[model samples]
Target: MFESLKKKFSRTSEKLEEELIEEAEAEDNLQEESGSRFSFFSFGRKTDEKKEEEVVEEEENLLPEAEEIEEVPEAEEVEEIPEVEDEEIEEEPKEEKKSRFWHRNKDKDEPAEEAEDEEIEEEPKEEKKSRFWSRNKDKDEDEEDVSADGEAKGGIFSFVREKTIQEKHVEDILFELEMELLQGDVAMEVATEVVENVKENLVGKKIKRSNDITEYTYYALKDAVEEIISIPGKSMTEMIEEKKAQGEPLVVMFVGINGTGKTTTIGKLANYYLKKGYTPVIAASDTFRAGAIEQVTYHADNVGVKIIKHQKGSDPAAVAYDAVEHARAQGKELVLIDTAGRMQTNTNLMDEMKKIKRVSNPDLVIFVGDAITGNDATEQARKFNDAIDIDGVILTKADADSKGGASLSIGYVIQKPIMFLGVGQGYDDIMEYDPEWMLNQLFSEDEEIVENEA
Candidate 1:
């Protein structure tokens, strides 16, 4: 199925595994560093204590000099007593001001110097012990919390082996996945959505301690792929049969650029309906291109269905209108209209396609694209859908496409279901699209390795 896509995704998975391993090792290193930081912090506290002791000694030495300065003179003591009493009264307000300053700025200038000195000498031991214990305690709590994220608080050798996918790690993996998708020719919008979906599934998710990181990654990626390809209630065959059951012929119009196997897919579709017992009529409305009528005619003959056509360069809208009327008149169950192949950038051709769509009002407007076209096929489908409002897609040459970008992204980009895939040149090679089947193919490692070896 998606062998090429499988390889691409496998490479991405390998990269993810490598990154996870690196992150686990880094976590182990971080834990070790935390222990070393604890030791350093303890040694630093002792050094700070020693410095505090030296500062205390310096303060004590300065005390005697300070007292000498206070010995103003005993002779003047009596005369200064009355002045001292006045000074004391006046100095009370100054002391009050110094007290306020000390509180405001924790100053040690005057009024609170003794108190500040006493506090300084006594507080460091308690402060250091408290700080040291609290820091290590918080570190322990953080390690415990880190364990909750995916890795348990393991011993030095065990942490690296017990890595888990964290939110941060998921972001890194998504970035890498996006790059890989782009490289694999997945469209930017599709790639972005895929990664976003993966992120939503992975972020904040706590894996069981016994679970491997790769298991979570695999689920996230599988969910993402399934999401990208899924379009609920948009099955083309069901819609076609619904219209048929409503007593109307199911008219399906195919549109895409040249060489996308539009005609071949039309033949395959007719064969598909024929086997289901639905009478089909092929409409050769692609009159603009040389030999387009002959091509559809050959397919009609090969599929054993009647074909309607006009000469070269006939109005395609008229052809579609006539074909639908023919199918209705003949009581046919299906009408597969093959339109001319033209580049999506060609405005005249796009307008022509839109006119055909308006005229026929097909039950399903299918955009046929080459799966081998890679990213360009997605853009082609988008433009075609914009012009004609395509109901679904039928990818051709899928087996030849090693990258499988178009198959993976066309539906996501255009918001349409991929109805079928043309696996090979044989008319019977086509098959219905199944998202689950595709995902299974993508995630299959054995198949991927075998295909890669080939």
Candidate 2:
């Protein structure tokens, strides 16, 4: 009897479960269609219990079936409705996994340490990159016109090459050249320009041999000389002929700083005149210096020429006047007056030289100059030219160490021909100063052997 009650009770519960599910599904469907006032989950527990008791009562009163109903399979009893796993299940697992991973990885901080290490390494790299770019920016700009600018290129190499004085020792070469130019009395502008030009040429050059350096210096120096001395001047023969055609016995004079061979030049000129068959009469007007007259007299005797003499401290103008007078009386073709060697800038002495020229009324006034006076020689030539309108230059001491370097300036400024040269101490030392010969002497590489041949 108890077993039958339990069976009735289990069947009643199963029927109630099915009815509740169906009712809930119907209510859900009705809500979707009619916009229902209440949800299916709002069903009360007391109403559901009452429905269960009624289902049990109806099950017991049901008549016995004539035909048996096929039993539902066991698999169908747990009807799989997508084997529903909650989406929240996945969310919970993801959250649990994240927390567990964080807890486990907390002790293994190698990833964070590696990231810090990467940052530290990157900091120095960035700094080094900034420095490298900063240093090479200027060189990069220079290399933009690489064909034209042969300078240090970009990078640490350029800095090292330029600052460290490692560009084939160019800095040393330029430094030494600067010092040498200063000692040579080169003008600051000229010297600096030369250095700049040469530096521009050599900035990026890779000169490896001594010969290249030597050639470079040679060209640089040669170019400077050419720049200063490019002007052409009057020749001594041209001046003489021009004056001689105008009149007989043109008066040629010598002027220079003392000990610049002014007196000796007068003698050499007389000898040169004798060779030209011009009857030369020497004027002994340099009475101020001891042996000035006697020295000229000795040259006169050797060259077999006539000379006019006066006592010491005599008026030079009077001596010149007498010499001119003697030339006219004897039909002497040329009169070379030996004047006193005085500072060309001295006012009184320059006045005296002017007076001598005025009284003599010379057809041509030849300015005998020293070729080895260097820069001062240019100044001397200018002073002498300003004094008496110098007709030509007789550059003496051409064989000296200075090698007529001053001729370029003197000749260029005077715009007159160089007439003669005093190459040595003797008579044969006196030779016609040829322009081409002088150019060779000035620019040539061969050693000039200047003995006292005269």
Candidate 3:
């Protein structure tokens, strides 16, 4: 289904992831330098504190020497005093000694108090330094917490912005992705939409600890593709059954450009209903082509179903009217009408198609397309839909298309459900369309089983 797209995206992811990891590593190196600078600042502050403590210790050692010099001078003064004033001098010395005793005690108390005050001041300084380091640690921890929070916010579908994904890298990736899509045959508008979606998803988003950048990118790609192809509509079988319940034979008109297997798809559709136990009638309204009637008649004979057709150059609308009338008379449950293949730009042919649609009043107008034609098929589908307002689509040659971009873009571009796929060349080669199944075929790998299935 989308095998080519998957391989292309896988290569892109590997390339993008390699670049992002390199950038992240460079950022980590810068962070390491910042951490080293903070450590150096802390070391310098510790050295300054050590020098101040050494100065304080030297001042304490000088205090005792200065006190001894003062004591020697006081002793000499007592010896020089005369006998007449010996008693007074002795009393003076005693008074001096008493004052010295009181002064020494006060000096002793001052040293103890100064030491106590220094210890008190040093405790707060140590506490302040501890708080400074603690704050730095807390800041680092907070950064980690924020990254975790961002991952939580993104959950499984998106990524939250915490650590910025480099915009330059994203732009580069988008450019490469666009080129790849174009090379794979995706329409230009669809390619641009895909790139925009991926950019919106990944730019500025935080990379989770448990996830990789490549993972985020892959999610965005898958989401964008599924959104593009998954048009909201009723299931094919359900619509058919609903129309059947109305008690009128369900008429489906198939339209497409030449060589798109429109006639073969109608035959397959008729065979499909026959297996389901419903009477089917084939209408060969492609009477303009040389062997269109013979082609449809061959399918009718192979499937053992009734066919309403006319000679070449007959009115296609008249052929459709006869087919519906025959179905109602035969109590048939389904009518598969094959119209002539013509280019959408052919005004005359387009008008003829409109007449057939008006005359038949088909319950469903289906546009058959070739998956191998890629953008050409999509453009044709758009033109046909614009002209005749098709209800759904049936894509032929799906198995042969390696790129398969048309199948991915048609439904989204035209806002129509793709009802079936022509996988091979047989009446039983057709399969009901399943969006999930298509996705699985595109993305499923052993390593990505669940996500690819999704």
TM-score of each: 0.67, 0.51, 0.68
Whole-model lDDT per candidate: 0.72, 0.57, 0.75
The most accurate candidate by lDDT is: 3
RMSD of each: 25.5, 47.7, 28.6
Q: Name model 2 segments beyond 4 Å from true.
A: 1-179, 185-224, 364-373, 402-408, 413-417, 446-454
The better candidate by lDDT, 1 or 2, is 1
Instruction: Using TM-score as the measure, name the better of candidate 1 and candidate 2.
Output: 1
Q: Per-residue lDDT for 1-454 in model 3, tens only?
A: 5667877776666566556645655556211111111111122234446879999999999899889889999999989978888677568778888999999889877887888888888885454334422222444332332221121111111123224576787888789889988888888888999889988887877763214565676677777887877887776567667867887788889999989998888888888889988888988899898988998899889989999988899999999999999988877888888999999989999999999999999989999999998999999999999999999999999999889789888888888999899999989999988887776566544323212211
Q: What is the lDDT of residue 263 in candidate 3?
A: 85
Please, what are the lDDT tens digits per residue for candidate 1 over residues 1-454?
Answer: 5555665554554455456545665656322312211110122234446879999999999799778876776556867577668877997899899889778765444556777788888886454334432322444343432321222222212242444456676666678778877888899988898888877876665432212344555567777888888875466567667877787888888888888888989998889888988899988999988888998899889889998898898888888888889988888988888898899889988888888888999888888888887898998888888777888888888878777788889888888888899988888889998887676566644423322222
Ranking by lDDT: 3, 1, 2
Model 1 scores a TM of 0.67
Per-residue lDDT of model 2, residues 72-176, tens digit only: 454565575344455655678898999999977885866787788888898865543444323224444433322211211222111111111124444555655
lDDT of 1 at 391: 82
263 Cα displacement, candidate 2 (Å):
1.2
Candidate 3 or 2, higher TM-score: 3
Clashing pairs in model 2?
Answer: 150-204, 234-416, 234-417, 235-417, 236-419, 249-333, 428-454
